[model samples]
Target: MDIFLIILAFVTLLIALVGSIVPALPGVPLAYLSLWLGRWSGYTPFSDTFMWIMAGVTLAVFLADYFLPPLIVKKLGGSKAATWGSILGMILGMIFTPIGMLLGMLLGAFLGEIMYAKRSGYMALKAAMGTFLGFLLGTGLKLLLCFYVLYELVSTWWATGFGGF
Candidate 1:
């Protein structure tokens, strides 16, 4: 059962890595959950202090993904409609392809600024840029966190002889 759980933990970590980029999954939280699974499996992969710290960090990162982009948009003079359009685009963008989310977000923000916000073309572009930059920043942060967690998990397992699997 330990071995099975360890394997499941690894699998979840892998999905978290993919989720870092996909935007559909909450990557950082899932990675933290994987670490907890390892702890629950009796591997004791992290210290109590480390676990608490990671929990806080994971929650922060998860919230950042939601708050960062909108903050950036607003700072750059984006309207509420622009934020909603970007979100809608992200959902609709999932239909065509993974990269479509980025593009859809860009388009949606532009349209929102122009139509709803009554912003000029240059201003719309600026707001769209803010949204794009925010998304990229959030994704990058998630990827880094997930990769570090994955390394910790795999390395710990390897050090323990792969838990005798």
Candidate 2:
């Protein structure tokens, strides 16, 4: 049971780390789940209170990541079309992966502003830049959280050992 939990925890941690940058996966949430798996594996690196706190933090980060880009588009004078376009582009972009997602966001914001909002090129570009900034901010925050969780899990594994393996 312990071995199974440890393996599951490690695999999920790795995927969460990748997803932190990928934007398609629910990175922070997975990282939080790995912490629980680690606990169930008999490792006590963090207390229950700490885990609960982390759960709330993880949810906040996830929400921010999901909403920040569209909010930024709107804040930068982009129309609702641009906001919706950015969201759609991100989902479609997931097919190509990490870089595609960003490019797609920029293009989506730009095209939406151009075609629907009837904004000038420079204005559209500005909105796209804002969206890009939001993406960076969200990704960086998730990456930080995922790395921290990964570190704690690894430390727990190291300190506790694999049941004398």
Worst-scoring 10-residue span by lDDT in model 1? 37-46
In angstroms, what RMSD does candidate 2 have relative to the true structure?
Answer: 1.9
lDDT of each candidate versus the true structure: 0.86, 0.82
lDDT by residue for model 2 (1-165), tens: 887887898899889988887766778889998999989888646788898899899999999998886787778877777776676777778789767877887888788888988999998888888877888888898999988887888777788875446
Top candidate when judged by lDDT against the true structure: 1
Per-residue lDDT over 1-165 for candidate 1, one digit per residue giving the tens place of the 0 to 100 score: 888888888889889988987877778888998998887787646789999988888888888988998999999988887887787887889899878988999999999899999999999999999999989988988988898888888888787787876
TM-score of each: 0.94, 0.89
The TM-score obtained by model 2 is 0.89
32 Cα displacement, candidate 2 (Å): 0.7
Model 2 poorest ten-residue lDDT run: 156-165
